[model samples]
Target: MTNYVGSCLCGAVTFEIEAEFESFYLCHCKHCQKDTGSAFAANLFSQTGKLIWCSGEDNISSFTLAGSQHQKSFCKDCGTALPNNHSSGILVVPAGCLDTDVAVIPTAHIFMSSKASWESNVVNIRKLEGLPE
Candidate 1:
């Protein structure tokens, strides 16, 4: 019965997810990289979660890859990723979209074969709190 609240970057859309996430995954699929414009996508999956759109529901947009099962939901204004409930009854939530922290750590990194070459050994890179001088 846990409730997780979230909103888009522009605050144009808000929502709530009620249920414990079964797993959190860092997906490195090419489709994920293209959609997120990043090395990987952090996502939470829940089989029985309930989604409640609290505001600006009409501002939400979704896209499904024509030849694949890949799909994504976002806010039309700022294009922040949002939760999507698939036809198979699974709920997918972008971890970054949550307003509060989630207790579950990422369960695994998936589709590693498609992981970007430059993304390798990223942990060895120097950490910076902000842009380097």
Candidate 2:
């Protein structure tokens, strides 16, 4: 069994999750894009019982889109996404905040019909380890 650690950008919130993640999804839904302020959201799914908050649990905040099941949790101090527990017994973890390696790669891109026009053809852009010169 493996364990993964994660933290908010300001380190104000930290957590651990048992390495029971089963699937990875790159969601392109409008809610995901807006919540992440990016092209998509990388989410790891597991049972809700797998998550354990190591510290600063009080700093976490959650939001839900009106009239939808779309929900997100984050650190109120640094605005880094945290895990969310769904009533369906599922846990959604933001891949960006995870400090450990994701052994399982994302199997597919989902909700592409809602993807932004600027999100495609990314193979043409210059990649970088940090910032550009």
Candidate 3:
């Protein structure tokens, strides 16, 4: 199995994933949207991957919504999403945090019924390298 390295936004937390991700998913569940503050969360799933904290372990924090299975781990300093184990014992890594290339692309968008109305048309938006005037 290939191991991948990742880090938090502020570089305050570094970690490794030991195993190839079985699949990737874009979740549009309401909880996912709120947790990421975006249309959805791109998460890699691997039941066999072992999460290893390479550095700055103390800078990591996690939160689970009360009475819900929704949970997220992040860097306390920069609020960047980090990897965490799902309750189902699957390793869930936010795809964006990885500095290494992920060969596998997202399989599908789950919970699409809950997706935001403005989210689907993003592909049609004008591409820009920076904020538009």
Q: Which has the greatest TM-score? A: 1
- Give the alpha carbon lDDT tens digit for every residue of 1-133 in model 2: 5789999999999998885777899999999889989999999988634889999999998898889999889999999999988757798989999999889899789999999999888879989999887
Error of 1 at 84 (Å): 0.8
lDDT of 3 by residue, 35-129 (tens): 88999999998989999999999998899999998889999899999999989898999999998899998899899999999987899988989
Task: Itemize residue pairs with steric clashes in candidate 2.
Answer: none
Report the C-alpha displacement of residue 103, candidate 3, in angstroms. 0.5
When 1 and 2 are scored with TM-score, the better candidate is: 1
- Which pairs of residues collide in model 3? none
All candidates' TM-scores?
Answer: 0.97, 0.94, 0.94
CA lDDT, candidate 2, residue 65: 81
User: Could you tell me the lDDT of residue 76 within candidate 3?
Assistant: 89
| Candidate 3 global TM-score | 0.94
The whole-model C-alpha lDDT of candidate 3 against the native structure comes to: 0.91
Worst 10 residues of 3 by lDDT: 12-21
Model 1 segments beyond 4 Å from truth?
Answer: none
Clashes of 3: 0
Model 1, global lDDT: 0.95
